[model samples]
Target: MKKLIEVDHVSNERVSNVHFSLMEGSLTTIIGPSGAGKSSLLLLLNRLEDPDKGEIHFKGKKISDFPISELRRNIGMVFQQAHLFDGTVEENLKFGPSLRKKWEQNDGVKLLEKVQLSEEFLTKEVENLSGGEQQRVAFARTLANNPEVLLLDEVTSALDMRTVELMEELLHKLVKEEGKTILMITHDLKQAKRLGSYTLFMNEGKVEEQGETASLFQHPKTAALKHFFEG
Candidate 1:
């Protein structure tokens, strides 16, 4: 598979000398203890926060070479908390595409369906939706931009177990059908194990171990990783 994004010795206030490559159409989970820089690493991917040093390349070109808006649109981000505009769900879904003048007549309904929301949701107010619904709307809104890569920062953390499971299912469908490259951050080891095709285990701002999910979990090579699974 092609490498969609490459992180080369990236560093920031909270992250240090981190390195990894996101494979196209792959789901990679970033896991570690609190203050391990998972969120910081994600911010660098979408340019929400720039690294103090090192470079990030997208599709063999430097990320800095791409226009910020273009780069961000192609690499969308969904945070733990869904931030919706004070408007109808359809309006929120239209926000990103409208900015780029790429709005389609059926985009709102199509995206809603993609996120498992019905057409009727188009008329509902975002604030009136439940947490799970809001998160789904957020995902749909990001999808409207037609991003190739999705940087998910603990997107399921605030959701209930059922909601989280639904979100995971939706994500799997997206990977299988839409071919989205997802880089997710999670504190839940079980969720990571279940969803991640590849896993990166970090500590003290550095990646300590990384490999296929089953291999890393079943045969950790580092002492830190062994203790993490054992404990």
Candidate 2:
């Protein structure tokens, strides 16, 4: 796998000395308590927000070398809340590719299936759909672009147990089938281990512990994560 992004000696207003290298076409979970700068890390990758100091390279090139619009298009993001436009479901899904004429009907339908939604959802209005349904639509829209990386910011937080489980199952399959390089941030340890092959545990704006998901959980490296579980 290629090293898509390298967070080298990064120091921001929120975090300092955060360094890590993320591989392409692999799922990496950023696990931490709230305010650990995990979301900040994701922002750096997409260049939505820039870092104060350090080098962030993508595909062996500096992140700044890539055009912001083009970089964002290639890295699809799913927020905690599904920010759908005030339109029909079909219209919302068509928003991105409508301008570029890149996304297709088959791609939309395939993404809908990946998110475990029926074709009937395409016609429904966004306002009428439930939270879970809306998020499924958002996930479908993200996949519409065939992004190399998927940044999920607490994607399952507001979802019900049933829906979260369903989406997790679908994401697991998508990673293997599509070779998606996924970076997901979650407070839920169970969900992280289930979804991530590798996990990084952050505390006080630092990566205190990190390892394979199974090993890290079973044998935590830092008192922070240990206390987190014991408490």
Candidate 3:
């Protein structure tokens, strides 16, 4: 498969000299201890934060080469917090496509359905929704833009078990069927192993080890990774 994203010796306040590549249509997970720069790495990838050194390339072009609006539109991100606007679900779902002058009334409903939310949710207020419901909306809003790559920062951390499972199922469909590339930061080791085909194990601001998910988890090459699995 072609490389979708390439990070070369990238560094910032949090990440240190990290280098890796995410293959097209692959589901990869970033696993590490807290403060390991996992979230910071995501920020740098989408230009939410620029690296102090090195560079990032997406689909063979430097990320800096793309216009900020275009880059963000194609490389979308969803954070742990829902971060929804103060409005009804329909409004939030329409935000991205509307900004790009591509909005259609049916788009919101379809996007909601993709995230397993029904059409009735379109009229409901975001603030009134439960944490899981709000998260699904946030995800649906991101999907409204129809991005090629998704950078998820612990998006399921606060969700209940049932909702988390549903979100995971949706993510699998996205990769297996929709053919989007994904790199997710996850604190749950089991979720990482189960959800991702490839895994990057990070610690102390660097990717200490990376390989196929099962192999990396079963036989950690670095001491930091071994200690992480043990802990």
* Model 1 lDDT, full chain set: 0.91
Query: Which 10-residue window in model 1 sums to the lowest lDDT?
Result: 222-231
Structural RMSD, model 3: 0.7
Please report how far candidate 3 places residue 91 from its true position, in Å.
Answer: 0.7
Tens-digit per-residue lDDT, 1-231, candidate 1: 899999999998998999899999999999888888888888899998999999999999999999999999999999878998999999999999999788988989899887788999999999899998999999889989999999998999988888888889988987878899999999889999999999999988999899999899889999988877776
| Candidate 1 runs further than 4 Å off | none
Candidate 1 vs candidate 2: which has greater TM-score? Answer: 1
User: What is the Cα-based lDDT of residue 107 in candidate 1?
Assistant: 89
lDDT of each: 0.91, 0.83, 0.94
TM-score of candidate 2 on Cα atoms, chains taken together: 0.94
Backbone clash numbers for all candidates listed: 0, 0, 0
Q: How do the predictions measure up, each by TM-score?
A: 0.96, 0.94, 0.99
Question: For candidate 3, which ten residues in a row score worst on lDDT?
Answer: 100-109
Q: Candidate 3: where is the Cα deviation over 4 Å?
A: none
lDDT score for candidate 2 against the true structure: 0.83
Candidate 2 lDDT tens digits, 1-231:
778878888878776678887788778899888898888878877788888999888788887898877787778888888999998888888777776887676666666777888888888899999999998898888777777888899989989999999988877776888778888998787888888888888877788887888899899978899987775
Best by TM-score: 3
- In candidate 2, stretches whose alpha carbon ends up further than 4 angstroms from where it belongs are none
Better of 1 and 2 by lDDT: 1
